[model samples]
Target: MPTPIPANARNPLRTFRFRIRMNTSAAGQYVAGVRTVSGLSVHVSPFEVWEGGNNLHRYAQPHKVNWEPIVMEQGLALDDTLERWALAVLEFARTGKAPGEAVKRDVFIDLWDGFAHPTEVPAPGPEARIRSFYVHNAWVSKYHALPKLDAMAGEVALLSLELTHEGWEPVPKPPASKPASPA
Candidate 1:
């Protein structure tokens, strides 16, 4: 009998790190360790219909698609970049100022298949295979500042922002090239 390899054994792609880019205007604001991305998900509602009599087995029908909000966390910084970005949407919501064109921006979450590597401008390329997800028309819905501070050892202050987006789609990759025909 041959020895079977474990499912999670020696998988490089299993571990990944991600960074966020809030459109072109608010680019390069998110620092790697300062911010952590989470809660990028979608769910489909299951439709169930029950009538009188004839109960064999109940099957669920696929209903509307629901997209969950993307959550981001970061340590408090002096620049206050995230705080200002989130407040811009809040200001619009409160006074109906429309938030201008900058408010309606595309948010990109890029996943890199490895640990964090130091670079001036870290981007997805040959060295680190990256898969980016574009969240269309995103705006910060929730911005929670630092939680209750306590005199505890080794506690880091963190801020969180929840972004509500219309939809999320993966960045399209270029099609594979075809091999030349034999002469």
Candidate 2:
């Protein structure tokens, strides 16, 4: 069975290391790190601000934000899938909150069998760009049979500080923000 084409191939979401700077005079550059997608990725974590704190003076709280595009890039239906991922993430960034789990529903999708095929990429070490990917094994098996451990999810070993606050509750209500005007 051949792979399915991305229903949304025309325009995929743009995932990047985005930094929202809270500028300060001279050079006190404060920033908000975030992880966002095109709004279809389900079960995605939401956004939260990094309030200040420290641990025994060894490290101070990261006042700025740190972000990444969370979904894996297994290509194929890459465009459509990424769009969903982007939109979901963006919603979180603006609201500084996660969409309630009750509002999320998990659906499976097809992706490359990289986890099952080591030669496809490489022995992902602690230095690889992507850590892992989830394959709808139902789809994988329907297309190609698995010879070994029938696994659906594959993870890479690389480490990254993704999503500044994956588990921080927003204030009673986030202060309303105004749209940015042209500089």
Candidate 3:
């Protein structure tokens, strides 16, 4: 018989308990206070192949792969990293000069185990991290600087950025270290 999973591991990781890290600079800073994240997905197109003798059946094979644009929304804050990045891309388009490394960045989304209270999600340490998605070669495609301003509304001001990325993959877990032998 197969071994059963432990009780503690049965629960799914909560979506709210996560962190977004953008490779904005060589220092590698984390984008703080992100309210929402979406569009972490990929689609593979399939091509149909039919053998000359086998008219009865057709085989479908994977072809081109496409990655969806990731959208992130956050309450407007003092930090201007998102704005600056978007402006850089705009400048590139205006001047016809390549933005080079300044516009493109790798984004990391880390999902943490939500064992704590909803109001008290702790910062994920290495062990607390359940999984991480690595978004490669992402550049800002759209920037919504301000939402529909309404003085009568009670909602917070939100700024959103959409990023087009080449692809994304799950970050691989590190190898386990071996215990030292008795001397």
- Give the C-alpha miss distance for residue 166 in model 1, angstroms: 1.7
Error of 2 at 136 (Å): 14
Model 1, 1-183: lDDT tens per residue? Answer: 999976534333643366666664644344444456777899999998765585876778999889998888887864466777787888888898865435666877766654434333434453443577888998888889876688875777888888888999998644545689899
Q: What are the per-residue Cα lDDT tens digits for candidate 2 across 1-183?
A: 999866533211223422221211333231222232222222434344443674333433435433322332222221233233334455665686764321122222111112332224323232222222221101000111112333574732221211221221111322446789999
Candidate 2, which segments miss by more than 4 Å at Cα? 1-71, 74-78, 96-183
Rank candidates by TM-score, best first: 3, 1, 2
TM-score of 3: 0.81
Ten consecutive residues with minimal summed lDDT in candidate 3?
5-14
Question: What is each predicted model's overall lDDT from 0 to 1?
Answer: 0.70, 0.28, 0.81
How far does residue 119 in candidate 1 sit from its true spot (Å)? Answer: 7.8
Task: Give me candidate 1's TM-score against the actual structure.
Answer: 0.71
TM-score for each prediction?
0.71, 0.18, 0.81
lDDT of 3 by residue, 80-162 (tens): 66777888888887897866538788988988777644666655456667788999999889999999999999998888999
Indicate the TM-score of model 2.
0.18
